[model samples]
Target: FQISYAGATDSSVQFIFYQPIIHGWRETDFFPCSASCGGGYQLTSAECFDLRSNQVVADQYCQYYPENIKPKPKLQECNLDPCPASDGYKHIMPYDLYHPLPRWESTPWTACSSSCGGGIQSRSISCVEEDIQGHISPVEEWKCMYIPKMPVFQPCNIFDCPKWLAQEWSPCTMTCGQGFTYRVVLCIDHRGMHTGGCSPKIKPHIKEECIVSTPCYKTKEKLPKEAKLPWYKQAQEPEEGTAVSEEPSFILEGWSTCSVTCGVGRQVRLVKCQVVLSFSQSVADLPIDECEGPKPVSQRVCYSGPCSGEATEYTPEKAELLYGSLQEFDEQYDWEYEDFTECSESCGGG
Candidate 1:
């Protein structure tokens, strides 16, 4: 005999299962020391693994697995063995053929604005170079055109603030069966200071809105977990939580090519700022009037030294023979050379 059954609409079915929490961590073997013999350094790093497939993941994942484990050092000194003596050539200190020229240098960074989360920090950089007399002199931006300028803005101290601070709420703890609410609670003072002022009893509730109902069917599609914590917070509590806009400020562009390659010369470059009306516009596209802050120096003196490679060095006597008198020689050939090559190579060995 065969039996057939029909079910009414809206009938419900429930299944229960448990997934074990997984923790995985590992340290790589040390790499070969950097130096051939003398002293050098070696390195290694700790990493986390995916429990289900045993594949390597980001190191941060390991922290949640083996709770309370301390971080390990990734670098160490090694290769203490001494090197053999060199074969006869004396070691001479190397020097840059070009003189210590002027260039831009960035000062040390200032302290972070806040102890946690988001805050702004900045540093000042200036053009500088050494003069022929061995003195450090502040040069015009143009004189330091060889290198790119350093940026003055950067982010710092971006980790999660602390436990007392209120974090946004998590999704409803359960789909439909028995649901509960959850959120992050940080302990801190009114001024956002990491203090114990928050009373244990008054802390925002971590669980709420409980309900027992039929289980809702879940789809196989899932959203990936967020990887980074929010880095910044508003300076003041605003209703919309929008960021305050800073006034437009001028930022200097890298120096342009020198107008003249050698001798006392000059160079010029355009400077611009982020004008409110020119949002997302390239620097060159912004009009000069849009630059609201202090205008950057558009032109500056660039001393590349007297034009070189034009004339070769020759003895005073040789100069006199060619130009008749020392006075005449000096007048006609103010620029001089040390010696004429067997073939004035620069002059095609004339």
Candidate 2:
């Protein structure tokens, strides 16, 4: 029979050997047991037996044992490849991938994606996306520059005046005339159209008056005409018919002439008299020693005959009586005839 010991130490092995064995044999004949019997067992032989036999016994004992062993810890290591050293990645680096590069031609390294799900592409470094939702690229733009035009004044033509008068007046004076005025055109810089008023140097006078005339259509029509008399010229009369005197009288104050005749005791007066005296009898009676004629008398004569009788002797006293008397004379009276007819006839001739 074989025996197996699972908990056998050197001391326990000694105890099992030293204890009494039953139905055993010994290698020496010093006892009643032979070597084959339990009494004669060697420690080496016991160790060999325990090694093989205890393995089977341990398997059987595993059913009754509790499994208190902890599981092994996991050993994890980084598997992904390192990012490229030249350009930063959107997910890995601090760079913002959604924004566009400032300029693509100048700076080629920068790039952008089309959209969230879209792929990325290289572009200008300076190209920047617009802040608005649908917009992209430029922040500012340029426009064409605008300019204005200047003002100019244009003077009118004044060749319509009568030819003779035009020769005497300047062209400007002839055109503008007394009542009419002139003005100039105006222009602005850079602007295509002209606008606004002319400068003070070119502006027309405010009080200018206009003259109406027919407009000339051709060169021949513009030629000057001969001067004619103005409407306001004074009228004159012929020199015949008793030489009308410009001097005026009462009956014909503005008339130019008067006719006179004398006969018998009546005579026309021809005197270098003041034109004013013709209307004033009082002025005619004033003293004039230069007129030494016979004194005028108021007399009545009958039968159309001069006084005819013997002549009386002449004396200063009688002459005064004859000249100063206002009396009737008879044809039978004696009177001397003095020829005063020459004075009367001469006074009437003109």
Clashes of each: 17, 46
lDDT of 1 by residue, 34-115 (tens): 4454444455655677778888877676666446363353555565455555733232222222134356888889998876
**lDDT of candidate 2 over 1-350, digit per residue (tens):** 33555564553322233422112211211212112211111111001112323322323233232442212222111212334555453223221232222222223433333222234444332323332133555421110001111122222322221111101111221122222222222232223333332244543232233443533233653243442221122122111222212121111113222122211121122222111122121121112221222222213111212334524433445434442332333223323433121112212221
TM-score of 1: 0.23
RMSD of model 2 against the true structure:
54.0
Which structure among the candidates has the greatest TM-score? 1
Instruction: RMSD for all candidates, in order, please.
Output: 39.9, 54.0
lDDT, candidate 1, equals 0.49
Off by over 4 Å in 1: 1-98, 165-202, 205-350
Candidate with best lDDT:
1
